[model samples]
Target: MKITLPGSKETLPVGKILCIGRNYAKHAAEMQSDVPGEPMVFLKPSTAIVRSGGVVVLPKQSKDVHHEVELVAVIGKGGRNIPEDEALHHVSAYAAGLDMTARDIQSKAKANRHPWSVAKGFDTFAPLGPLTPADQVGDPQQMEVSVTVNEETRQNGRTADMIFSVAYLVHYTSTIFTLEPGDLIYTGTPDGVGPVEDGDVAEARVSGCAPLRVRMSRELD
Candidate 1:
Protein backbone atom coordinates (compact mmCIF):
# COMPACT_ATOMS: atom_id res chain seq x y z
CA MET A 1 0.00 0.00 0.00
CA LYS A 2 1.15 3.54 -0.73
CA ILE A 3 0.60 6.41 1.72
CA THR A 4 0.91 10.12 1.04
CA LEU A 5 2.38 12.56 3.50
CA PRO A 6 0.93 15.90 4.47
CA GLY A 7 1.43 18.79 2.00
CA SER A 8 2.81 16.31 -0.55
CA LYS A 9 0.90 14.18 -3.00
CA GLU A 10 3.85 11.93 -3.65
CA THR A 11 3.09 8.48 -2.30
CA LEU A 12 5.56 6.53 -0.19
CA PRO A 13 5.56 2.79 -0.63
CA VAL A 14 4.81 1.03 2.65
CA GLY A 15 7.49 -1.54 3.47
CA LYS A 16 6.20 -3.00 6.72
CA ILE A 17 4.27 -2.30 9.91
CA LEU A 18 6.15 -2.86 13.17
CA CYS A 19 3.94 -3.02 16.24
CA ILE A 20 4.90 -3.01 19.94
CA GLY A 21 2.80 -4.97 22.38
CA ARG A 22 1.86 -4.20 26.00
CA ASN A 23 4.03 -1.12 26.17
CA TYR A 24 1.79 0.54 28.72
CA ALA A 25 1.53 -0.74 32.26
CA LYS A 26 -2.21 -0.11 32.54
CA HIS A 27 -2.88 -1.79 29.23
CA ALA A 28 -0.75 -4.75 30.23
CA ALA A 29 -2.66 -5.05 33.44
CA GLU A 30 -5.98 -4.86 31.63
CA MET A 31 -4.90 -7.69 29.37
CA GLN A 32 -3.51 -9.67 32.30
CA SER A 33 -0.11 -9.59 30.69
CA ASP A 34 3.20 -8.81 32.29
CA VAL A 35 5.21 -5.80 31.21
CA PRO A 36 8.11 -6.99 29.12
CA GLY A 37 11.70 -6.20 30.12
CA GLU A 38 12.22 -5.21 26.50
CA PRO A 39 9.96 -4.38 23.61
CA MET A 40 7.62 -7.06 22.35
CA VAL A 41 7.61 -6.85 18.59
CA PHE A 42 5.22 -8.00 15.89
CA LEU A 43 4.93 -7.47 12.17
CA LYS A 44 1.97 -6.56 10.00
CA PRO A 45 2.31 -6.55 6.25
CA SER A 46 1.46 -3.51 4.13
CA THR A 47 -1.78 -5.18 3.06
CA ALA A 48 -3.10 -4.58 6.55
CA ILE A 49 -3.17 -0.82 6.07
CA VAL A 50 -6.52 0.92 5.69
CA ARG A 51 -6.22 4.46 4.49
CA SER A 52 -7.45 7.31 6.67
CA GLY A 53 -11.26 7.62 6.61
CA GLY A 54 -11.58 4.16 5.09
CA VAL A 55 -13.83 1.31 6.09
CA VAL A 56 -12.59 -1.49 8.35
CA VAL A 57 -14.32 -4.56 7.02
CA LEU A 58 -14.42 -7.09 9.80
CA PRO A 59 -13.38 -10.65 9.03
CA LYS A 60 -16.16 -13.18 9.44
CA GLN A 61 -13.93 -15.78 11.05
CA SER A 62 -13.88 -14.08 14.44
CA LYS A 63 -16.53 -12.65 16.76
CA ASP A 64 -14.50 -10.39 19.02
CA VAL A 65 -12.45 -7.65 17.41
CA HIS A 66 -10.64 -4.74 19.07
CA HIS A 67 -9.20 -1.32 18.36
CA GLU A 68 -5.82 -0.17 19.69
CA VAL A 69 -5.00 3.51 19.30
CA GLU A 70 -1.37 4.47 18.87
CA LEU A 71 1.09 7.04 17.67
CA VAL A 72 2.70 5.94 14.41
CA ALA A 73 6.18 6.97 13.36
CA VAL A 74 7.00 6.96 9.66
CA ILE A 75 10.60 6.26 8.75
CA GLY A 76 12.42 8.56 6.36
CA LYS A 77 15.87 6.99 6.44
CA GLY A 78 17.02 3.40 6.65
CA GLY A 79 19.57 2.32 9.21
CA ARG A 80 20.53 -0.54 11.51
CA ASN A 81 21.98 -0.51 15.02
CA ILE A 82 21.05 3.14 15.21
CA PRO A 83 21.89 5.07 18.32
CA GLU A 84 18.97 6.27 20.44
CA ASP A 85 20.08 9.86 20.09
CA GLU A 86 20.12 9.52 16.31
CA ALA A 87 16.91 7.50 16.06
CA LEU A 88 14.59 10.46 15.65
CA HIS A 89 16.67 11.56 12.65
CA HIS A 90 15.36 8.53 10.79
CA VAL A 91 11.76 9.60 11.34
CA SER A 92 10.08 11.51 8.56
CA ALA A 93 6.64 11.96 10.02
CA TYR A 94 4.13 10.95 12.67
CA ALA A 95 0.45 9.99 12.55
CA ALA A 96 -2.44 8.61 14.52
CA GLY A 97 -2.97 4.88 13.98
CA LEU A 98 -5.28 2.07 14.96
CA ASP A 99 -4.09 -1.50 15.38
CA MET A 100 -7.17 -3.64 14.81
CA THR A 101 -7.26 -7.23 15.91
CA ALA A 102 -9.40 -10.34 15.93
CA ARG A 103 -9.27 -10.87 19.67
CA ASP A 104 -10.63 -14.41 19.68
CA ILE A 105 -8.15 -15.48 17.07
CA GLN A 106 -5.32 -13.75 18.88
CA SER A 107 -6.20 -15.49 22.11
CA LYS A 108 -6.24 -18.86 20.41
CA ALA A 109 -2.90 -18.19 18.78
CA LYS A 110 -1.44 -17.23 22.12
CA ALA A 111 -2.63 -20.46 23.68
CA ASN A 112 -0.93 -22.47 20.96
CA ARG A 113 2.18 -20.29 20.97
CA HIS A 114 1.63 -19.55 17.27
CA PRO A 115 2.49 -16.52 15.22
CA TRP A 116 0.03 -13.59 15.34
CA SER A 117 -0.06 -13.18 11.57
CA VAL A 118 -3.58 -14.54 11.23
CA ALA A 119 -4.93 -12.58 14.15
CA LYS A 120 -3.27 -9.20 13.67
CA GLY A 121 -2.31 -9.10 9.99
CA PHE A 122 -5.67 -9.01 8.29
CA ASP A 123 -6.55 -6.54 5.55
CA THR A 124 -8.05 -3.24 6.85
CA PHE A 125 -6.67 -3.98 10.30
CA ALA A 126 -4.21 -1.09 10.40
CA PRO A 127 -5.79 2.35 9.97
CA LEU A 128 -3.63 5.47 9.81
CA GLY A 129 -4.12 9.23 9.49
CA PRO A 130 -2.31 11.79 7.39
CA LEU A 131 1.38 12.05 8.20
CA THR A 132 2.66 15.22 9.85
CA PRO A 133 6.31 16.01 9.17
CA ALA A 134 8.69 15.37 12.02
CA ASP A 135 9.70 19.01 12.18
CA GLN A 136 6.06 19.93 12.87
CA VAL A 137 5.68 17.55 15.81
CA GLY A 138 7.95 18.31 18.75
CA ASP A 139 8.43 16.05 21.74
CA PRO A 140 6.38 13.06 20.60
CA GLN A 141 6.51 11.63 24.08
CA GLN A 142 4.23 14.34 25.42
CA MET A 143 1.51 14.05 22.81
CA GLU A 144 -2.00 12.91 23.72
CA VAL A 145 -3.19 9.77 21.94
CA SER A 146 -6.73 8.52 22.07
CA VAL A 147 -9.52 6.50 20.49
CA THR A 148 -13.28 6.91 20.40
CA VAL A 149 -15.98 4.47 19.42
CA ASN A 150 -19.19 6.02 18.14
CA GLU A 151 -18.13 9.35 19.55
CA GLU A 152 -17.77 7.98 23.07
CA THR A 153 -14.23 8.15 24.39
CA ARG A 154 -12.74 4.72 24.98
CA GLN A 155 -8.96 4.79 25.04
CA ASN A 156 -7.26 7.91 26.35
CA GLY A 157 -3.66 8.42 27.38
CA ARG A 158 -0.61 10.52 26.76
CA THR A 159 2.50 9.28 24.98
CA ALA A 160 4.20 9.90 28.28
CA ASP A 161 2.71 6.62 29.49
CA MET A 162 4.73 4.59 27.00
CA ILE A 163 6.98 2.10 28.74
CA PHE A 164 9.43 2.28 25.84
CA SER A 165 10.03 5.61 24.18
CA VAL A 166 9.62 6.10 20.44
CA ALA A 167 13.32 6.66 19.84
CA TYR A 168 14.18 3.49 21.71
CA LEU A 169 11.66 1.49 19.66
CA VAL A 170 13.23 2.71 16.42
CA HIS A 171 16.73 1.91 17.61
CA TYR A 172 15.69 -1.51 18.92
CA THR A 173 13.65 -2.46 15.88
CA SER A 174 16.36 -1.35 13.47
CA THR A 175 18.76 -3.73 15.17
CA ILE A 176 16.53 -6.72 14.31
CA PHE A 177 15.12 -5.59 10.97
CA THR A 178 16.75 -3.11 8.64
CA LEU A 179 14.78 0.12 9.01
CA GLU A 180 13.58 1.54 5.70
CA PRO A 181 11.74 4.55 4.44
CA GLY A 182 7.93 4.21 4.80
CA ASP A 183 8.26 1.62 7.52
CA LEU A 184 5.74 2.39 10.28
CA ILE A 185 6.22 1.83 13.99
CA TYR A 186 3.08 1.60 16.14
CA THR A 187 4.22 2.69 19.59
CA GLY A 188 1.63 0.64 21.45
CA THR A 189 -1.77 1.48 22.94
CA PRO A 190 -3.12 2.47 26.31
CA ASP A 191 -5.78 0.85 28.45
CA GLY A 192 -9.53 0.70 27.59
CA VAL A 193 -9.20 -1.44 24.48
CA GLY A 194 -12.49 -3.15 23.74
CA PRO A 195 -14.63 -4.75 21.03
CA VAL A 196 -15.93 -3.09 17.89
CA GLU A 197 -19.06 -4.28 16.19
CA ASP A 198 -20.57 -3.66 12.79
CA GLY A 199 -21.42 -0.05 11.98
CA ASP A 200 -19.25 1.26 14.78
CA VAL A 201 -17.17 4.29 13.96
CA ALA A 202 -13.66 4.23 15.38
CA GLU A 203 -11.63 7.41 15.50
CA ALA A 204 -8.00 7.79 16.50
CA ARG A 205 -6.20 11.00 17.28
CA VAL A 206 -2.59 11.85 17.99
CA SER A 207 -1.71 15.32 19.14
CA GLY A 208 -0.71 17.43 16.12
CA CYS A 209 -1.72 14.83 13.52
CA ALA A 210 -4.89 14.44 11.51
CA PRO A 211 -7.53 12.26 13.12
CA LEU A 212 -8.00 8.82 11.59
CA ARG A 213 -11.67 7.85 11.26
CA VAL A 214 -12.96 4.49 10.10
CA ARG A 215 -16.33 2.77 9.96
CA MET A 216 -16.57 -0.88 10.85
CA SER A 217 -18.42 -3.35 8.62
CA ARG A 218 -18.92 -7.06 8.87
CA GLU A 219 -18.17 -9.13 5.82
CA LEU A 220 -21.35 -10.71 4.49
CA ASP A 221 -21.16 -14.47 4.62
Candidate 2:
Protein backbone atom coordinates (compact mmCIF):
# COMPACT_ATOMS: atom_id res chain seq x y z
CA MET A 1 0.00 0.00 0.00
CA LYS A 2 1.08 3.57 -0.67
CA ILE A 3 0.72 6.53 1.70
CA THR A 4 0.73 10.19 0.80
CA LEU A 5 2.56 12.55 3.07
CA PRO A 6 1.93 16.25 3.44
CA GLY A 7 3.98 18.74 1.38
CA SER A 8 5.47 15.91 -0.64
CA LYS A 9 4.10 15.02 -4.05
CA GLU A 10 5.57 11.53 -3.74
CA THR A 11 3.79 8.66 -2.06
CA LEU A 12 5.65 6.15 0.08
CA PRO A 13 5.00 2.44 -0.34
CA VAL A 14 4.26 0.76 2.97
CA GLY A 15 6.20 -2.30 4.05
CA LYS A 16 5.66 -4.57 7.05
CA ILE A 17 4.21 -2.66 10.04
CA LEU A 18 6.07 -3.69 13.16
CA CYS A 19 4.37 -2.95 16.49
CA ILE A 20 5.49 -3.00 20.09
CA GLY A 21 3.14 -4.30 22.78
CA ARG A 22 2.96 -3.61 26.49
CA ASN A 23 5.45 -0.81 26.15
CA TYR A 24 3.53 1.27 28.66
CA ALA A 25 3.33 0.01 32.19
CA LYS A 26 -0.09 1.53 32.89
CA HIS A 27 -1.51 0.02 29.72
CA ALA A 28 -0.04 -3.35 30.61
CA ALA A 29 -1.60 -3.12 34.03
CA GLU A 30 -4.95 -2.21 32.53
CA MET A 31 -4.80 -5.31 30.36
CA GLN A 32 -3.69 -7.46 33.29
CA SER A 33 -0.41 -8.18 31.54
CA ASP A 34 2.94 -8.11 33.26
CA VAL A 35 5.56 -5.57 32.23
CA PRO A 36 8.04 -7.25 29.94
CA GLY A 37 11.77 -7.20 30.58
CA GLU A 38 12.19 -6.47 26.88
CA PRO A 39 10.01 -4.89 24.25
CA MET A 40 7.09 -7.15 23.32
CA VAL A 41 6.73 -7.21 19.56
CA PHE A 42 3.94 -7.90 17.09
CA LEU A 43 3.07 -7.42 13.43
CA LYS A 44 0.23 -5.93 11.46
CA PRO A 45 -0.02 -6.12 7.69
CA SER A 46 0.04 -3.06 5.47
CA THR A 47 -3.61 -3.73 4.55
CA ALA A 48 -4.55 -2.75 8.09
CA ILE A 49 -3.79 0.90 7.45
CA VAL A 50 -6.60 3.43 7.14
CA ARG A 51 -5.43 6.94 6.49
CA SER A 52 -6.66 9.83 8.58
CA GLY A 53 -10.37 10.66 8.25
CA GLY A 54 -11.11 7.09 7.14
CA VAL A 55 -13.68 4.74 8.65
CA VAL A 56 -12.83 1.69 10.75
CA VAL A 57 -15.21 -1.12 9.82
CA LEU A 58 -15.56 -3.24 12.90
CA PRO A 59 -15.41 -6.94 12.13
CA LYS A 60 -18.50 -9.08 12.74
CA GLN A 61 -16.42 -11.70 14.51
CA SER A 62 -15.53 -9.40 17.37
CA LYS A 63 -17.88 -8.25 20.10
CA ASP A 64 -15.48 -5.80 21.65
CA VAL A 65 -13.11 -3.63 19.64
CA HIS A 66 -10.81 -1.27 21.53
CA HIS A 67 -8.82 1.78 20.54
CA GLU A 68 -5.13 2.31 21.29
CA VAL A 69 -3.58 5.66 20.43
CA GLU A 70 0.14 5.55 19.67
CA LEU A 71 3.13 7.44 18.37
CA VAL A 72 4.33 6.02 15.05
CA ALA A 73 7.86 6.21 13.68
CA VAL A 74 8.22 6.05 9.91
CA ILE A 75 11.46 4.60 8.63
CA GLY A 76 13.27 6.50 5.89
CA LYS A 77 16.38 4.36 5.71
CA GLY A 78 17.08 0.65 6.01
CA GLY A 79 19.56 -1.12 8.22
CA ARG A 80 20.16 -4.13 10.48
CA ASN A 81 21.75 -4.38 13.90
CA ILE A 82 21.57 -0.61 14.22
CA PRO A 83 22.85 1.11 17.29
CA GLU A 84 20.38 2.85 19.60
CA ASP A 85 22.14 6.19 19.43
CA GLU A 86 21.92 6.25 15.64
CA ALA A 87 18.48 4.68 15.26
CA LEU A 88 16.69 8.04 15.09
CA HIS A 89 18.76 8.86 12.00
CA HIS A 90 16.89 6.12 10.14
CA VAL A 91 13.46 7.64 10.85
CA SER A 92 11.93 9.83 8.19
CA ALA A 93 8.84 11.03 9.96
CA TYR A 94 6.48 10.72 12.90
CA ALA A 95 2.70 10.30 12.92
CA ALA A 96 -0.12 9.81 15.34
CA GLY A 97 -1.72 6.39 14.91
CA LEU A 98 -4.34 4.14 16.37
CA ASP A 99 -3.88 0.42 16.85
CA MET A 100 -7.48 -0.78 16.92
CA THR A 101 -7.95 -4.22 18.39
CA ALA A 102 -10.54 -6.97 18.61
CA ARG A 103 -10.22 -7.35 22.32
CA ASP A 104 -12.45 -10.40 22.57
CA ILE A 105 -10.49 -12.17 19.87
CA GLN A 106 -7.21 -11.13 21.41
CA SER A 107 -8.21 -12.40 24.84
CA LYS A 108 -9.15 -15.78 23.39
CA ALA A 109 -5.96 -15.93 21.37
CA LYS A 110 -3.90 -15.18 24.45
CA ALA A 111 -5.71 -17.82 26.44
CA ASN A 112 -4.92 -20.35 23.76
CA ARG A 113 -1.31 -19.25 23.34
CA HIS A 114 -1.94 -18.16 19.76
CA PRO A 115 -0.47 -15.33 17.79
CA TRP A 116 -2.21 -11.92 17.96
CA SER A 117 -2.05 -11.27 14.22
CA VAL A 118 -5.59 -12.47 13.60
CA ALA A 119 -6.92 -10.19 16.31
CA LYS A 120 -4.85 -7.21 15.23
CA GLY A 121 -4.46 -7.66 11.47
CA PHE A 122 -8.00 -6.98 10.23
CA ASP A 123 -8.26 -4.38 7.50
CA THR A 124 -8.85 -0.82 8.82
CA PHE A 125 -7.45 -1.81 12.20
CA ALA A 126 -4.66 0.71 11.90
CA PRO A 127 -5.50 4.38 11.40
CA LEU A 128 -2.63 6.78 10.77
CA GLY A 129 -2.26 10.52 10.34
CA PRO A 130 -0.09 12.53 7.99
CA LEU A 131 3.61 12.44 8.64
CA THR A 132 5.62 15.22 10.31
CA PRO A 133 9.18 15.05 9.04
CA ALA A 134 11.51 13.64 11.69
CA ASP A 135 13.41 16.91 11.89
CA GLN A 136 10.16 18.73 12.63
CA VAL A 137 9.34 16.50 15.57
CA GLY A 138 11.23 17.62 18.64
CA ASP A 139 12.26 15.21 21.39
CA PRO A 140 9.82 12.44 20.52
CA GLN A 141 9.91 11.08 24.04
CA GLN A 142 8.68 14.37 25.40
CA MET A 143 5.60 14.53 23.20
CA GLU A 144 2.09 14.19 24.59
CA VAL A 145 -0.03 11.45 23.01
CA SER A 146 -3.77 11.31 23.42
CA VAL A 147 -7.01 9.79 22.10
CA THR A 148 -10.57 10.95 22.11
CA VAL A 149 -13.83 9.21 21.22
CA ASN A 150 -16.82 11.30 20.24
CA GLU A 151 -15.04 14.36 21.61
CA GLU A 152 -14.54 12.82 25.03
CA THR A 153 -10.98 12.14 26.10
CA ARG A 154 -10.26 8.44 26.48
CA GLN A 155 -6.49 8.35 26.68
CA ASN A 156 -4.02 11.05 27.67
CA GLY A 157 -0.39 10.24 28.26
CA ARG A 158 3.17 11.10 27.41
CA THR A 159 5.76 9.27 25.32
CA ALA A 160 7.98 9.57 28.34
CA ASP A 161 5.96 6.81 29.98
CA MET A 162 7.01 4.23 27.45
CA ILE A 163 8.91 1.30 28.91
CA PHE A 164 10.87 1.16 25.67
CA SER A 165 11.95 4.24 23.76
CA VAL A 166 11.45 4.65 20.02
CA ALA A 167 15.17 4.53 19.29
CA TYR A 168 15.66 1.37 21.31
CA LEU A 169 12.70 -0.33 19.65
CA VAL A 170 14.19 0.41 16.23
CA HIS A 171 17.55 -0.96 17.22
CA TYR A 172 16.02 -4.10 18.70
CA THR A 173 13.55 -4.80 15.89
CA SER A 174 16.26 -4.40 13.24
CA THR A 175 18.25 -7.20 14.79
CA ILE A 176 15.42 -9.63 13.97
CA PHE A 177 14.16 -8.25 10.65
CA THR A 178 15.95 -5.97 8.24
CA LEU A 179 14.51 -2.48 8.52
CA GLU A 180 13.46 -0.98 5.19
CA PRO A 181 12.32 2.34 3.91
CA GLY A 182 8.57 2.90 4.41
CA ASP A 183 8.47 0.50 7.32
CA LEU A 184 6.49 1.74 10.37
CA ILE A 185 6.97 1.10 14.03
CA TYR A 186 3.96 1.61 16.33
CA THR A 187 5.45 2.54 19.69
CA GLY A 188 2.54 1.18 21.73
CA THR A 189 -0.19 2.86 23.78
CA PRO A 190 -0.86 4.13 27.28
CA ASP A 191 -3.73 3.39 29.66
CA GLY A 192 -7.47 4.13 29.23
CA VAL A 193 -8.19 2.01 26.17
CA GLY A 194 -11.88 1.17 25.89
CA PRO A 195 -14.53 -0.04 23.49
CA VAL A 196 -15.86 2.15 20.71
CA GLU A 197 -19.41 1.80 19.53
CA ASP A 198 -20.56 2.12 15.96
CA GLY A 199 -20.50 5.68 14.65
CA ASP A 200 -17.98 6.71 17.28
CA VAL A 201 -15.38 9.10 15.95
CA ALA A 202 -11.95 8.44 17.39
CA GLU A 203 -9.10 10.92 17.14
CA ALA A 204 -5.51 10.21 18.03
CA ARG A 205 -2.80 12.81 18.39
CA VAL A 206 0.84 13.24 19.14
CA SER A 207 2.38 16.60 19.91
CA GLY A 208 3.83 18.35 16.86
CA CYS A 209 2.00 16.03 14.41
CA ALA A 210 -1.33 16.04 12.67
CA PRO A 211 -4.21 14.39 14.46
CA LEU A 212 -5.62 11.13 13.08
CA ARG A 213 -9.40 11.03 13.05
CA VAL A 214 -11.51 8.01 12.11
CA ARG A 215 -15.10 6.90 12.57
CA MET A 216 -16.09 3.41 13.69
CA SER A 217 -18.73 1.41 11.86
CA ARG A 218 -20.11 -2.10 12.00
CA GLU A 219 -19.58 -4.51 9.13
CA LEU A 220 -22.54 -4.73 6.86
CA ASP A 221 -24.16 -8.10 6.35
RMSD of each: 1.1, 1.2
Clashing pairs in 2: none
**Candidate 1, 114-188: lDDT as tens digits:** 998899998999998888999899998999999999999999999999999999999999999999888999999
Q: TM-scores of the models, in the given order?
A: 0.97, 0.97
Work out how many backbone clashes candidate 1 has. 0
Report lDDT (CA) for all predictions: 0.93, 0.94
- Candidate 1: regions farther than 4 A off: 5-9
Writing each residue's lDDT as its tens digit, candidate 2 over 78-194 gives 999999999999988999999999999999999999999999999999898988998999888999999999999999999999999999999999999999988999999999999
**In candidate 2, residue 175 scores what lDDT?**
97
Residue pair clashes in candidate 1: none
Model 2 residue 212 lDDT? 95
* Shift in Å, residue 87, candidate 1: 0.4
